[model samples]
Structures are given as structure tokens and as C-alpha cells.
Target chain A: MSMTMTAIVLGMTVVTYIPRMLPFVLLKGKELPSFWQSILQNVPYATLGALIFPSILTFHEDPSFALIGAAAAFLIAFTGANIIITVLGSIGILTVLSLFL
Target chain B: METTAAAQSEFKDGLAAGTGIAIGYVPAAITYGLLAKSAGLTFIETMSLSIFVFAGAAQYIALSLITIGTGIFEIVLTTFILNIRHFLMSAALSEKTEEEPIWKKAAYSFGVTDETFSVAAMKSGSIHSSFMAGLILISYSSWVLGSGLGYVAGNAMPPVVQESMGIALYAMFIGLLVPSLKTSLKAVLLAATAAILNCIFTYSGALSSGWAIIISTLIASISVEMAGRAREKGGIE
Candidate 1:
């Protein structure tokens, strides 16, 4: 890698590392107020939900098949499937849909 | 010796648990690689990205930024913004993790991608360093390896299949979200509200996807939390 590229890569690594490490490193053995804790706790679910939409629709050029994949995943997951089966089942559904399209 | 054995077993279980995430990562990382190849990144450039950065969405954003001839500073800033949510994830996980040295915490924290954080957050007990190591090893290697393979495979994969791979990660999100939604009304509301807000921010061109996620998550979480408090007071009244 060029020195420039190496610097960019290292820069990226440092920036990403700070966010992931600072909180974990600094917050140990400290108790957050319950209100803030609840907010933090809800963050994972909220983030997951936010991540799924809009992007899911844009997953393909045409979203109809993508919606099918999403639906299939929701149904499977609602039935208590693990992440792997849910992903594979939806992929399987999309593959069939793609075949027809 | 006994402690080493226990840590080994924990690590083994973590590896087993992270397998699902590793599978979900394959297609996305490969897609990133294929995109990187077309954008004119060399194999080393591409692998350096996956190896050093390790955040999928941020890396993709970086690739696009690089492709457009954006400066390194801008690209780095964009990555930092895109991945800012890791702060919350790390904070939440800190509560779950067994207290360890700062160095140990920093080491495993580096691997806390969105999916891994979700997995670790949802698990019932304290997170050990060895368990985190095992979980991250499988997921990280799979992502880096997939990107390399995609760069190598390069346009050989069918178009339909290439696009279909996009659905896998979203499907993983649905799979993760549904059970949480079912168990807690707050979770359902939180998820739905955040999704709606994200869609609004995205289509309206009001916010970047990264900002949209962070804002929507904070808004939905706070609103749901307040609503829960209100309901409890009403029940008492």
C-alpha cells in the first residue's frame, strides 16, 4: 500500500476503534442512572429496526422481490427461527422469486 | 488450568453462537469486495479495508467516498459518523461484560459490529473476554475472507444471485427484531417508530442514512421509554 493509503487505513481504524472502545473501557464498574440505562438498552432494538427498513427496500434495484424476502424472514423469525434459518429461508424465497422474474 | 479450561469452553460456545452471523456476513462482504474491485481498488487496498476497518456499512461508505475521489479526511470523518452508534453498543455491553482489564475491554470492543453487539446484548449472562474473542474471530474472519473471495470471483457470480445476496442481511435484521418485538410492546413501538422515522429521513433527503439511524434510534427509544413511564403512572392512578 502507498504511504497515503496506509495512513488512510490507519486513520479509519483509529476513528472506528475510538467509539467502540471508549465507552466499554471507561464505563466499567459504573452504574448508569436507570433512565439512561433504559435508553441505552432500547438502543439495540431501535437500531436494528431502523437498519432494516429503507435499506431493505433498496436492497435490489426492484424492491418487490426484496419485500418478499423481508416478509419471508419476518414470518420465519416470528415462528422463532434463529438468525441463520431466517436469513437462509428468506434468501431461498428471494432466489425463487428471482428465478421467476 | 481450571480457569483456562473454562475460558476455552466459553470461547467454544461463543464460536458456535457466532456462526449464524458469520454466514449472514458472507454475501454482504463479498458484495463490498466486488464493488471495491469495480471502483478500481487493488486487492491489497480492498483487503486492508476489511482487515483494518471491519465495519461493513462504514467500509461500503468509504468505498463510495474513495470512488468519488473524496479526500482521506472526509472519508475518515464519514466513517467515524457512520459508526458512532458503536458508543452506545459498547456502553450497553459493558454492563453485560465481566469486568476485565482496560486493554482486554479495548481489544474485544474493537470487534463489536452491529450484529455482534445485537447478539451479545441479547444473550442472558455476563460476557467473558474469551467468549467475545471466539465470537469475533469467526465473524471477523468470515467477513475478511468473503471480501477477498468476492474480489477474486469478480463478475462471475450471476446478477440475480449477486442482488439476492443483499436480502440476507436485512433478513437477519428481521429475524433478530421479530422476537424482541413479540416479547415487549415497547420493543415493537421502538422498532416501528424508528423504522418509520428512518424511512422519512431517508426518502425526504433530510438526513444521511447514518444520521437517520442515530436520530431515529434516539427519538424512538426516548419516546418509548417516556410512554412506558406514563403508562405505569396511569396504572397506579
Candidate 2:
């Protein structure tokens, strides 16, 4: 890899690490408010939704393809399909759509 | 007296969880090692990134941006923004695990990942240090191993194939959303809201894709919280 690429990658490693590590360090043994506790409980769902939502809608040539695949994956998962199947099914459907479109 | 025993137990549980996560990580890390090498990253560079960044999505984003000749400043800014969710995750986990020593907390924090957070949160009882440590260790090992493997396998695959591998993270995210949807209507609403907001933002051209996520999340989360509160007040199920 180029020197610049290497540096960028390394730099990113540092930035990402700090954020992940800070709370464990700073908040250790510190009591947090109940409101903060409630908020924390809800944050993961919100954050994950935020992270995954855009991709499901926008990752394909026809946004509908992604939407359909996501819906299928969601249904399958909701119905208790194994995780591997859910992901593979979505990918398979998208790939097929890609081939056709 | 009981508290100390509980603390010890929590630490042990954390270690066990970390080990379990690490077992799965071995293959994935190998894949990552191959990817990095093909992307023109050297062994040491890839290792450093795996050791430090440890975030799959952000690292992949950084890699893509670098390959496309995005400026360093832009890349860094985008990554920082994309990873803002960690603040929320960490803050949440911290609340649950406020009994550990500072150094131990810091070490465990370093190992936080999406999988670790999920595993830890899903545990049935009060959060303990060992369980948290177990979860983190498993995830941390998987990540390091995956990156190492990706670097080694990097040269063997075509760029197209490597790019396709990028979907694994998205696939995992989908897996996460699906299971949760079965248990809670709130989760479904939050997810659907996020999707709608994401589509709106993408189409509006008002916000960049990265920022769009942050914006949509905030809006959707607030809406869900409000709607939930209203339901509770009305004595509705």
C-alpha cells in the first residue's frame, strides 16, 4: 500500500478506538442518572435503525429492489429464519434482480 | 459481600462471551486480511488498523473513500460522523456497567463492537464485568483475526468480488433488525421510521448520505419515544 493510504488507515484506527474506549474509561464506577439509563436502553434500537435503514432503501440501482429484499429478509427473520438464511436470502434476491435489471 | 462475588462472576461471564465471539471471528478476520492486502495495504498497516479502528463499517468506509481518492480530511470527518452512534452505545453500556475499576472499564470499552453490545444488552440479569468482558473479548478477537485474514486473502480476489464482500456488514445489520422486530412493535416502528426518513433524505439531496443517517435516526427516535409516551398515558397496550 501507498504511504498515504497506510497513514489514513492507521489514523482512522486511532479515531475509532478513542470513541469506543472513552465511555468504559470515563464512566467506570460512576453512577449515571435514571433518565440516562432509560435513554441508553432505547439508543441501540434507534442507532441500529438509523444505520441500517438508509442502506436497505438506497443500495441498489432500483431502490425498490433493495426495499423488496429487505422486506423479504425482515419477514423471514420475523418468522424465525436463521440469521444466515436471512442474509443469504436477501443477497440472493438482490443478486437475481441485479442480473435481470 | 454478595456484591464482590457478583463482580467476580460478571468478569468471568464477560471473558466467556468474549471467547465465544472470538471463535467466530477467526474466519472473518482472515477474510479481512485478504481484503486489505488487495486494497494495497501492507501487513503492518492492516494489523494496526484492525488493532485500533476495530469498527467494521467505519473501516470499510474509510477504505472505500481512500481508494476513490477522497481527501484525508473528508474521510476523517465522515468517519467521525458515521461513528457517532458509538457515543450512544458506549453511554448506554456505561450505565449498565458502572461498577468496574477505571482501567478495566477502559480495556473493556476498547473491545466494544455491534455484536458485543447486542450480546451484552441481551443478557437477562444485571450487567456484570465478566459477562461484559467475555462479550468484548470475543468480538475483539474476531475483528483482529478477520482483518488479518482479509489482508492475506486480499490479492486473490478481484476488486468486484472484494466490493461484494462489503455487503456482509449490511447483511449482519439486517439480521439484527429482523430478530428484534419479532419481539416489539416499537422496534418495528423505529425501523420503519428510519427507513422512511432515510429515503426522504436520500431523495431530497439536502443532506449527504452519511449525515442523512444521523439526522434520520434522531428524528425517528424522538418520534418513537413520543408516540410511546402518548400510548402509555392513554393506558393503551
Candidate 3:
């Protein structure tokens, strides 16, 4: 590869992998304090939540259809459908809605 | 007798669980590939980004930076900031899985994306490395393969169709978040807080998008957790 491409790839790899690898190296077999653990436990839900919400409203140019997509996802997910089904169902609803609305 | 069999079966169960993630990843990764192609990345460039970086949002940002002729230092810095959340994910996961050699831990940690982390976190009890490997294996491969496929398929698609596919990304996030929301009121409040905080940060132009996400996640979760603890102490619902 060209030097620039190689540099970009290596840089990307390092930055991406470090966050993933650091905690494993530092905290292996160790239990965090309960307060910290409680914070850690809520990380996923909070992060995923931050990614969605108002952001979903702006993801599509048509905010109305995006709402339909979000609602579809919420309905399927509320039913406790598997992740694949919930996502696919939402996309399917939006694709159909995109056609009509 | 049951121990070996259970371990073996758990690996299969992990693979089964990962199928949903794999399916979700394909469309998003495909969109990434298509976008990368439009941004002037060759097939190898797009594929290598997916293979090496392996983070969807980071790669998309990379494409944007590349298009703008951003310097390597800035691009790398942005991705680092964006992916810093993985540290929290890995830290949380460290508590749930059995101890293994740091090398194996390193290997599995590489696959810890937002989606896979949620899958692993939602599983009951201590997670087996074998199960993690199985889950990571399928989800990782689907991402790689989907990127390649999307790069190959980039040319034939119409512009409008490509634009519509963007919604699939948000839909996937909703799918991941909504299930958790159903189980707890705290989760719902946590999500709303994070979302509102993120929106304010971005709208106010007070912080970069990466910083916004990291700060919102930290503040919303830690505060909500403390509030929950306070409520419990006071014997309030």
C-alpha cells in the first residue's frame, strides 16, 4: 500500500483497538467498587439511548417517516422480538412508508 | 458429563444470538461501503478500513474527513474520541466474563462494538470466552463481508435508494435500545436524558460530536444511577 494509506490504516487500527484493549489489560480478574459497577452497568443503555432519540429525527430528511421508522422499531422491540426482527421490521415499515408517505 | 456438553452448546447459542447482530450489521456496513466508494475509496481502501478499524461510525467519519482532505492526525484523533466509549464497554464486560489470558481477552475485546456489547451485557450470568468468541466471530465476519459486498454493489444503486437506506442505521439503534427500555423505567429516563443532553451539546455547538456523546453517556448514566440509589435509600419508588 502507499505510505499514506498504510499510515491511515495503522493509525485507525491503533486508536480503535486501544479503547477496546485497555480495560481488559488493566482490570482483568478484578472487581470494581459497587458504585463504579453500577455506572458501568448503565453504560450500554445510556449510550444506545444517546445515539437514537432526536438524532433519529434528523437521520432522514423526512422526519415524519423517520418517526414511523422509530415507532416501528419501538413496537417490535417492546414485543421483545429478536434484534434482527426488530431492525428489519423497522426498515420494512419505513421502506413501505417511504413509498406511500 | 453435562459440563462439556453445556460449554459446547453455549458456543452454538452464542452463534445463534449473534445472527441478529450479523443481520443488522450488513445493511449498515453496506451503506458504509457505498459511502466510502462515493468518497473516492478504492475497494481495497474501503475493505481495509472495515477490516482494520472495524467500527462503523468511525469509518463513516473517516470517509468524511478523507473527502475534506483532513490530516491523518485530525482523523485519527476524531476516531479516538468517538470510540472512547468502548473503554466503558470493555470495563463493564470485564466484570461479567471469566478470567482468561490477556491475549484471549485482547482478541475478544477487539470485537466489542456497541451492538455486541449489548448482546453480551444482556446475557445472564458470567459469560464464557468461547461464547464471546462465537458471537464476535459471526458479527465480525458479517461486517467485513458486508463492507466488501457494498463496495462491489456501490455502482449500480440509484441516489434516492441510497439515501433511504440511511434510516436503517437509526432503526438498528432503536432496536438495540428499546428492548432495554421495556425492562426498566430507569433505562427509559437514562435514555431520554442522554438524548436530550446530546441534542443540546450538538445544537449549542458547545462540544464536538464525539465529546458530546461521551459526556452525555457519562453524565446521564452516573447521575441517574445516583438518583436511583438515593430513591432506594429513602424508600421511595
Candidate 4:
């Protein structure tokens, strides 16, 4: 890599590393308050919801196909089908739908 | 000798898993590479970003922001906001790593991607440094390899193929969500509320699709907690 690219890469690495490392350093060997801990427990659900919901619903120009695809994938996944199968099912459905619409 | 052996076994396990994750991530990372290249990044620049930035969504957002000539400060600020969840993930994993030395703990923490967190949390028995390290190494290597492939394969793919690859992310998300849906009503409610709020935000033009995720997730999570507390007091499920 060029010097400029190398420098940028290193800079980004440090910045990214700081965030990941901070909590481990600061929160280790400490007892968070119970209420805060409870709140923390919910963080994953919240973060995942935030990350997935918007993109699945309205981010696309026509979200219906994606929603249908998601619903199909969800149902299949819920039925204990493998993830690859579920995704393929959704993509298959979308491809078929595109043919019709 | 047994301890050393176990550690060796654990590191091998990590390397194996990292190899698997790298394989899974290749397609998506390739897509990112193509997008980055098409967005005017040189191959070196694109690969460097992947190696350093490492956060998938944030890297994509940064590329888009850069392409549109968003100010450096704004791009940095957005990257920071998007990555706020890493703080929570790191904290959760930190509690689970009580036995490791500080340096090992720090090294392992750097590899805490979303998939790694779920895998690590679900791991049985007391946390072993080697096992956790293996898990992280697997995930980190997968991410880097995927990014590299994406860079190399840039723009050679058909548009249809590119669009289809996005299904992988949605597929992965659904995989995560489906299991959780059965675990709790709070999970369902949280997901539904976020979906609704996301639609509202998108329609209102209040936030970009990415930022809407951060907003809706925060609101839905807080609401789920408050509602859960109220229900528990009232003996509601």
C-alpha cells in the first residue's frame, strides 16, 4: 500500500480499536448498578431491532417484495430449516415475483 | 501440560471457526469491495479500509458518505454513531471473560463482531482464553478475507447478482431474529415497534435509512424494557 493509504489504514485501526477496547478496560472488575445492568441486557434486542427493522421495511423503493421475502424466510427459519435454505427460499421467491411484477 | 494442550486445542478450534466465518463472509465482503471500487476508491484504498474499519455497515456508510462528498467530520461522526452498539457488545463480552489476563482480554475484545458475540455467549462452560481467542480469530479472519475478495471482484458481477447478494444480510438477520422470537414476547414487540417506527421515519424523511435503524432501535428497546417492567408488576406476559 502507498504511504498515504497505510497511514489512513493505521489511523482507522486505532480509532476502531479504542471503542472496542474501552469498555473492557473500564467495565472489567466493576459491578454495574442493577438497573443499568438490566438495561444493558436489553441492548442486543434493541440494537438488532434497530439494525434489521428499518432496512427490511422501508429502505427499498418497493419494500413489499423484500417484506414478503423476509416473511417467507422468517417462516421457514422458524420451522427449523437451515439458514442457507431459508435465504435461498426468500431469494427464489423474490426472483419469481420479479418475473411476474 | 494439560492446560497448555487445552489452550492449543482451543486455538485450533478458533482458527477453524475463523476459516468458516471467512468463507461465509466472502460474498458480502466482495459486494462491499465492488461498491467501494465503483465509488471511486482505488483497490489499495478499498482493501485498506476493510482491514482497518472492519465494521461492515459503518464501512458501507462511510463509502457512500465519502462518495457524496460529505465532510470528513460528518463521516467520522456518523461512523461513531453507527458503531455505538460495539460498546455494548464489548461490555457484555467483558463480563464473560473474567479469567483471562488483561492483555489477552484486550486482544480478544478487538474481534467481537456480532456473530462472534452470539457464538461466544452461547459457548458452554466457564470462559477459556484459548476458546474465546479462537472464536474471535475466526470471525476477524473471515471479515478480512471477505473484504479482500470483495475488493478483487469489484464490478465484474451483474446487477442482478449484486442485488441478490443483499439477501445474504437479510437472511442472516432473519436467522438471528427467528430464534429470538421464540424466546420472549419482548423480542417480538421490540422488533414490531422498530419496524413501524422505521417505516414512519423513512416516510417522513427525518433520517436516512441507516440512521433510522439507530433511532428506532433505541426507542423500541427502551419501550420494551419499560413495558416489560410494567407487565411483570401486573403479572402480564
Candidate 5:
């Protein structure tokens, strides 16, 4: 890695660590208010949702291919397949579709 | 209170439990490694990212940011929002663990990824730092090693195959989101709100991609919560 990339890595490490460590350190003996806890619980789902939508559409040569992959992924995951299957299933579907496209 | 012997035993059990998660991480981590390599990250940079950052979504965003030549400020801010949920996970896990040295707590907190959090949270009874250490060690090592392996594998693949691998990241994201959407209407709305807001921001040239993501996430989360609260106040089911 170059000096700039290394710096970026270090910067990310700091930002990532602070959140992971801060609550464990600060809230060691206490509980968050229920509302805050609820919000926190919702954070992952909301964040993941935002990150995936729209962006996934632009990921392949044809938007349709990305959509097919997304559909495969959503179906596997929604059916409660493990993460491995959910991911590989999407890739598998996309690969097959790519042949025809 | 945990004796040294008991801590040792629990640590063994923790490793055993973590084996399940470690197995689960292999494909996901390898995919991350492959994608990182395809994004033009070096082996060391890719492996170090898994080692240091350890958050999947944040790392993915980092790759996207780097590929787009985003500013450092934007990269840092975008990752901060993506991983801030770890605060809740760590705080919740802390309640489940017995009091240990602040240093120990600090060390284990670094291992608190979304998957590990689910495992630790699902564990019954008070948690032991030694057990946490074992669990974290296995999962962390699996991720770092997997990244290295994936980078090597990506290097061996044909260019056409590698290019198609771009879909892997999007597929990974969809895989993550859909499971939760199955269980919650609130999740569907929050994600839709963020996606729409992000599109508007990006298309209007009002904000860079990083700020667009951060703003959309915050607004979506807050608005969804407020709407839920309003429904509660109005006695709507």
C-alpha cells in the first residue's frame, strides 16, 4: 500500500474502532433508554437497506442482470438460507443469466 | 465471579461455539477479499482492511469510495455511519458479560461485528472475557485469512470472470437486507426512504455520494422511528 492508502486504512481503523469501543467503555454498567435501544436495533436493517437499493441496479453490464442477481439473493435470504447460500445463490443465478445475456 | 479455571473452560467452550460462526464467515470473507482485489487493492491492503476495520459494510463502502476516487473526508464519514450500529451491539453485549478489566473489554469490543454480535447476544447467561477472546480470535482470524485467500483466488481468475464478480458485492448486499425485510415492515420503509433520498441527492448534484449515504440513512432511520412513535401515540396497531 502507498502512504496515502495506508493513511486511509489507519483513518478507517480509528473511526471503526471508536464506535465499537465507545459504548462498551461508556455504557459499561448502564443500559440505554429503550427508545435509543430500539433505534439502534433498527440501524442495521435500515443501513443495509439503504446501501443495497438503487446501487445494486447499476452493478452489472445490463441492469437486468443486477436485478436478477438481487432477486435471487432476496429470495434465498428471505427463505432463511444461510448467508453462504444466499450469496452464492445470487452469484450462481447471475452467472447463468450472464451466459444468455 | 469467574475463577481462572472456570474462565479457561469457558474460553474453550467459546472457541467451540465460535467454530460455527468461523465456518459461516469463510465465503463472505473470501468474497470481500475477491472484491477488494478486483477494486485494485493490494494483498496487504486487503488483508489489513479485514484485520483493522473488520466491519463488512464499512469495508465494502471503503472499496466503493476508493474505486470512485472519493475524498478522504467522505470515505471516513461514510464508514462512520455504516458501522455506528456497532455501538448498540457492543453496548448490548456489555450487559451480558461479567465485569472484567477495561482493557479486556476494550479488546473484545473490537471483535463485535454484526455476525459475532448475533452469536454473543444469543448466548445465555453472563459472558466471560476469556470466552469472548476465544470467540473473537477464531472469527477474526478466519476473516483475515479468508481475505488473503480471496485476493489470491481473484488474481488467478480470468478477466471476464473477475469483471462479472462485480455483481457479487451487490448480491451480498441484497442477501443481507432481504432477510430482515421479511421480518419487518419498518425495515422496508426505512430502506426505501434512504434509497429514494440517496437517488435524489446524487442525481441533483446536491451532495457527494458519501454525504448522500449518511444523510439518507439518518433521515430514514429517524423518520421511521418517529412514524412508529406517532402510530403508538395514536393507538394504531
Candidate 6:
């Protein structure tokens, strides 16, 4: 890897680690305000939504192909299967689809 | 001698509890490896990410951003924002764990992913460092080793299958998102709002993907909170 790329990885490690570590170091029994708590709680779902959409459509040349695979995933996920199953199950569907295509 | 037996039992319980989380991480970590490969990351670079960062969503975001040539600064900043929830989880965990010296908290705190946090947080009583070591050991090995397995295994795959690995990440994201969506109207609103904002930012060519995601998440989360406040003021919540 180039120096810049390595730097990015190192930087990422630091940034990711700080949030996971800082609170335990700094906070004992104190609590942040509920407003901040509320925002933090919602951030993951919000980020996941942004992460999934439009990009999911753009993954395949045929948007429908991506949508179909995504739909299978959604169906399995709604059934409350875990993350691994949802991913592997959809990949299975797409592999079968790939064979036909 | 007695403490040794108790700690051993706690560790064993942690290992058992972490087993399901370990199993769950495998496919996602494998997919992360494959995607990192296709994104032109070197194997070392890819594994460095899994080993060091170890946060699933942030590493995936890093891959996508790297492909788009985002700067190190932007990537780091995006990671900080995306992972801000760790603050909350770590705070919750600090209270749950038995008091320890600074070094041990630093060590185990580094292992607290969203998965590990929830499992540790929900245990019946005050937690031991030994118990966390077991939980993290099982889950951490699966994530790190599973990623390496994905990269090495990816090399032998047909090129077509390699290309198709892209969809799995999205599918996983959907899997992650929809459960929360099912549980709450706020989750649904937050996701929809963020998706719409991200689509606009991306499709209009107004922002890079890194900035787009950060802005969209902030706006959507704030908006959801505002709507929630409005409802409360109106006596609807």
C-alpha cells in the first residue's frame, strides 16, 4: 500500500477507537442529556438508510437485478433472520440469478 | 483459587454467549473482504482495516470512499461521525463492568462493537473483565479471521462471482436497517428522510459520498428529533 493509503487506515483506526474507548475513560456514572442520547440512538438507522439506497440500485447494470436481490434480502430480513442469513440468502438468490443470466 | 474458578466460569459464559455473534459476523466480514479486494485495496491494507478499525460499517464506508478517492482527512472524519454511537455504548458498558484499572478498560473498550456492547450490556449483573475477554475473543476472531478468509478465498473465485459480491453489502445494510424500521415509526421516518436526502445529494452531484452520508444522517436524525418534539408539544407522542 502507498503511504497515503496506510495513513488513511491508521487514521481510521484512531478515529474509530476513540469513540469506543473515550467514554469508558472519561465518564463514570454521569449521563449525557436525553437530547444527545436521542440523536445517538437514531444515528445508526439513519446512516444505514443512507448507506443502502440509490447505491443499491446502482450496483448492477440492470437496476431491476439489484432491486430483486434487495427485495429478497428485505423479505428474509423482515422474517427476523440474522445479518449473516440475510446476506448469504440473498447472495444465494443472486448466484442462481447469475446462472440464468 | 476461588477467584480463578469464578473468572473461568465467567469467561466460559461469555464465550458461549458470544458464539451467536461470532457466527453472525462471518458472512459480513467475508463480504467486506471481497468488496475491499474489488475496490483495489491490497490484502494487507484490507486486513489492516479489519484488525485495527474493526467497526463493520466504518470499514465498509472506508472501502467505498477509498474507491472514490476521498482524502484521508475526510475518511477519518466520516469514520468519527459514523461511529459516534460507540460513545453511548461505551458509557453504558462502563457502568455495567466491575471497576478496573485504566489499562484493562482501554483494552476491552477497543473491542466494543455494536454487537458486543448489546450482549455485555444485557448480562444479569456487574460484569467481569474476564467475561468481556471471552466475548471479544470469540467475536473478534471471527471478524478478523473471517475477513482474511474472505480475501484469500476471493482470489480463487470466478471473476463474475467476484463482481457480484457488491450486492451483498447492500443486502446486509438492508438487513440491518429493516429490523429497526419494523420496530418504530421514528426509525422508518429517520431512514426514509436520510435516504431521500442522500439521493438528492448524490444524484445532483452536489456532494461527495462521504459528505453526502454525513450530511444526510445529521439532517435526517435532527429532523426526526424535531418532528418528535413537535409531536410531544402537540400532545401526540
Candidate whose TM-score is highest: 1
lDDT for B59 (candidate 2): 70
- Tens-place lDDT per residue, model 1, A1-101, is 77767877999999999999999868878899999889988888888888887888887878887788888999999999888888788877888787996
> By TM-score, is 1 or 3 better?
1
User: Using Cα atoms with residue i matched to residue i, what is each candidate's TM-score against the true structure?
Assistant: 0.95, 0.72, 0.90, 0.79, 0.67, 0.67
User: What lDDT does model 3 reach?
Assistant: 0.82
Per-residue lDDT tens digits of candidate 6, residues B105-210? 8898889886777567546688888898999999999999889988889456564565455576676677667777787888899888989999999999997665
Estimate, for each residue in A1-101, the C-alpha lDDT of model 5 and write its tens digit. Answer: 78868888998999899988997788776777877666655555555655665666775567877777777877877788755576567666766666776
Q: Candidate 6: misplaced stretches above 4 Å?
A: A1-12, B1-50, B55-105, B108-143, B146-153, B159-164
Tens digit of per-residue lDDT, candidate 4, span B1-237: 236887898778666544434444656687788788778788778877876677777778878877887765667677666666576677766766756667777877777665565455434455566877777766666667767666776566565545555555566567666787888887788778877887788779998665676577677767778887897889954
A best-first ranking of the candidates according to their DockQ comes to 1, 3, 6, 5, 4, 2
Model 3 residue B14 lDDT? 83
Q: Candidate 4 at residue A76, lDDT?
A: 80
Task: Output the lDDT of residue B172, model 6.
Answer: 65
- DockQ for every model comes to 0.81, 0.38, 0.70, 0.45, 0.50, 0.53
Q: What is the DockQ of candidate 4?
A: 0.45
Poorest 10 consecutive residues by lDDT, candidate 4 chain A = A3-12
Descending-TM-score candidate ranking: 1, 3, 4, 2, 6, 5
State the TM-score of the second chain for every model: 0.92, 0.74, 0.86, 0.75, 0.66, 0.67
| lDDT of every model, 2 decimals | 0.86, 0.66, 0.82, 0.68, 0.74, 0.80
Candidate that would win on DockQ: 1
Q: Model 2, stretches more than 4 Å misplaced?
A: A1-10, A25-36, A57-76, A79-101, B1-35, B68-74, B154-175, B178-180, B203-205, B208-210, B234-237
